[model samples]
Target chain A: MGINTFNIEEQGFLTTKLSEFIRWAQRNSLWPMPLGISCCAIEMMAFAAPKYDVARFGSEFLRFSPRQSDLLIVAGTVTYKMARVVRKIYDQMPDPKWVIAMGVCTSTGGMYRSYAVVQGIDQFLPVDVYVSGCPPRPENLINGLLKIQELIKKGVPPKRDPIFI
Target chain B: MEEKIDKIVESLGRRNIEAEIRQDPLGTEMILNVGPQHPATHGVLRLVLKLDGEYIVDAVPELGYLHRGKEKIAENMTFLEFLPHTDRMDYLAPLSNNTAYMLAVEKLFGIEAPKRAQYIRVILNELSRISSHLVWLGTFAMDVGALTVFMWCFREREKILSIFDIVTGVRFTTSYARIGGVAQDITDEGIHAIKEFIDNFPKELEQCEKLLNKNRIFIERTDGIGMITKEQAIDIGLSGPNLRASGVPRDLRKDEPYLVYNELDFDIPVYEEGDCLARYYVRLDEMKESVKIVRQCIEKLPSGPVKADEPKATLPKKEKVYTKMEELIHDFILTNFGGTPPVGEVYHAVENPKGELGFYIVSDGTGYPWRLKVRSPSFTNIQELKVRGKGNRRDDMVGRRGSIDTVMGEADK
Candidate 1:
């Protein structure tokens, strides 16, 4: 620390920053769509409640249209028959959108594994974050948001892939 | 050609279905069938939307896609065996279904569950409520196009599921609630986990609100869309948060306190808007109340045997049932064929996270129940879509569903 301080005094303190710009953008604006499918969505609502005020993250904008959103979070199971539509929605999302595979079902097809279920949606669309659990705690989702922020900040929009419509 | 078009138009007009002069004037409006497999509709719901351009002029919701004939299936099973299937009705809020059906059976048995079990059921049911609402908010956002909230909502939901897993050894589809009471007692670690979750869950919700609650786009899309007025919602038999959103204060839990609800302090959050936003708002606030209920249950949780002392009706404890001969025989009989109930019928309801989930069971003094019918919330809740979604846009279906929060597993069955 002393050496760094001395070096900062000497060399004006060079810093290694990862995803700084994208992080700033994410911190200022994080839009999430309510992708509730089953029971997990209730906890999702609690995450946005006053006590759990999701607004503290400055990312409370849950866009209703794919064009306006930068994030695609699949909070519940993505059954086989629904995969085509999920893929289509992912396809419809404009560029610079992030996909969060929420819940064990969306991340890994959960226990609803019949002949149906696409497992993880990452096979169809690029998933930036995978929140584990039948449904994860809201804090885990917050952590996920931060991690995605880091990814977004480090991510160059052009380099990071969005489904090219 | 014009005369033929006029004749076709004349015939179409008689059907009371709107036809417009889009590019395909001779052809009817574009038909897009949504669901049977959709993320936003909550289950395998199929909506036939007749659209003029992108505007939805007519919508028809098709149910029974996920129908496993639950009512018929229920008739084949014994009273005790039917508990697990109840859990599947509102899969998102299985605890509520489990509790409601158990309460009905308890009514038939003419026995009150121990205080501890009541509190546990309340705690679990509320937790289920929290989970269900989380899902509704997350996917409603996705259906309307916001995606990040889905992840945000699920993150906190994991804690509740972990709690359920801890208490019952099952997560989403839990059949933990038994005939007389819950199968097991909650551990200290489970309580601690719940405390930790309850303590920390709010901040995460705050983070989510930062992302959504007040975005202009979200407001515009949801503000006045999919309106279900108080009268309309009541006429349609909506329950749970959906009914509360329509400015009606109807909740089976609150109006008719059963189990541990009499001891807990909570209120039904209501909104007069009755639009998507009001529904969303009511559910959002209810989550806070749920956390409060869980905290209360945690604070007031009693120490006692989890199950009731009904030898003929209740399953023996694992320790005795597995080790002792008499207990073993009892267990074997219970497993092989559940006990018979006297000829009687009971209909029980609970405020499942989705809505009011009720089970009507008729016993015939045999090992199997004569009839079992589920008055599923999702089934009734889904009917609102047809009304709430009339004259809406194509992409707006997700928003309408986001408001109602239907589950096909329960609805179709």
Candidate 2:
């Protein structure tokens, strides 16, 4: 059986009829907005290239003007001033959006704990998946995408908004 | 009360929000501010655009958002300690940044990176070029409304980052490239992963080419956009793909021949269109060339110590430092970071992912440089935006901006 099928089988022990199709769709297509910051942004680029082919899952669409995007992949460090802009971008996206906090910088600010960095983007935005690595490999991003699909299927819509405005 | 507050907020130093409605001299066009903070502007650069409604008449780029006094920082930190900070300059290619700065210091001390270290640096630098090109391709696509390409590119990039992690134990801001040689040696797993990645990437390239390389939309959005003559490109001091696309065959790796780049075999892809499409094609072709270089670096990988065997110039081995008292003290000093360099001036330049990243260091015989200057590629590449942004539609400007692949962090730094 395919990995997705096996995953469904393993988790299907107590499956909900309502989430089955949603689970399948979410797993297959997790469109991500590439919120590139720095060098990690380039690695994020590599992940999207032919060798890794993120499109196989159906989320290859990296929407820029966030209105159409459903996923925000933070791929670099969020500096002090840039933090506000990141929040604004996340807010601009439509509902049902997922934030895959790619790389340690966006996950926990990585090794740069300087005064200029915001530590982790999650402090200001609700992160759905935190992909670790000083700068994560394309494999990590792929795995993170799958994990986010799992999270989406879990169907727990947490009500924690990082900003009130 | 809210309306008044909103008006106050809107008027309060809020520059470059929108060009649709802004004040300028009569007969002047709509002024599009490309950035104060933008994706392709490369760092915190701001552009004052004068558009005749939609056709830009003039463009002026305002810079200095990342002016954190880098030269001043160099003055404060020891020579080796300052290497990591240099990594932030052209961040998309930190290894190149690291190498150029390290080479500057090494030149001052008159030492060479070990053969093994040189080989690894060559591999990483070429990989950095490929990574940088992917970002350029993805974002350039996003700017043109081809969002799908971005995700596809990121998927492939993930593998490269993993390879980097295996070698350096860190990614993004890798201080892997250090003075005298690389700080850490590449492990066996790292080499295998890289080999697999290289072998598998060609098909991915084909997929991407199928997706957009010749798509009608991709052609329509980028073709003839951001047009520049070869003479204009040269006059502007444009380097890297921007220059190559304009029919200039200038590559620091070929011209300057630093590191093992001289020993490596690869092709430099060039084009003569001098437009958005040309630039895009150049970078895509460059990615293929970089892959060629990566493979060559792997095939000829030599065996030796990764760092210069010199004491005082290179850090002592970690194993010895742990056991030997004298070595331990040296290690402590290297980590603690505050030793002076012998006074002199040296400039080191590298063919970075963007373009030429040059470091000009003036040392007053101290660890800190008395005066430090970085010749950044993004900053130079961004300069061309002024020339291209003119006479373009509002929507078209973004696409034109994307072709340049400007990284604000490097530009501003």
Top candidate when judged by DockQ against the true structure = 2
Q: What are the per-residue Cα lDDT tens digits for candidate 1 across B276-383? A: 888888988989998899999999888897888887677899999868998888778777677656788888787788877777778777667778778888788878
Instruction: List model 2 lDDT by residue over B157-233, tens digit each.
Output: 66676787788877667888766888777888999999999999878977988989778988998888778889999
What DockQ would candidate 2 receive versus the native complex?
Answer: 0.20
**Per-prediction DockQ scores?**
0.08, 0.20
Give candidate 2's total backbone clashes: 35
Deviating ranges (above 4 Å) for candidate 2 = A1-165, B1-29, B33-48, B64-69, B337-340
Highest TM-score against the true fold, candidate: 2
In model 2, what is the error at residue A88, expressed in angstroms?
6.5
Off by over 4 Å in 1: A1-165, B1-25, B323-325
Global CA lDDT computed for model 2: 0.75
Chain B in candidate 2 has what TM-score?
Answer: 0.90
Worst-scoring 10-residue span by lDDT in model 1 chain A: A1-10
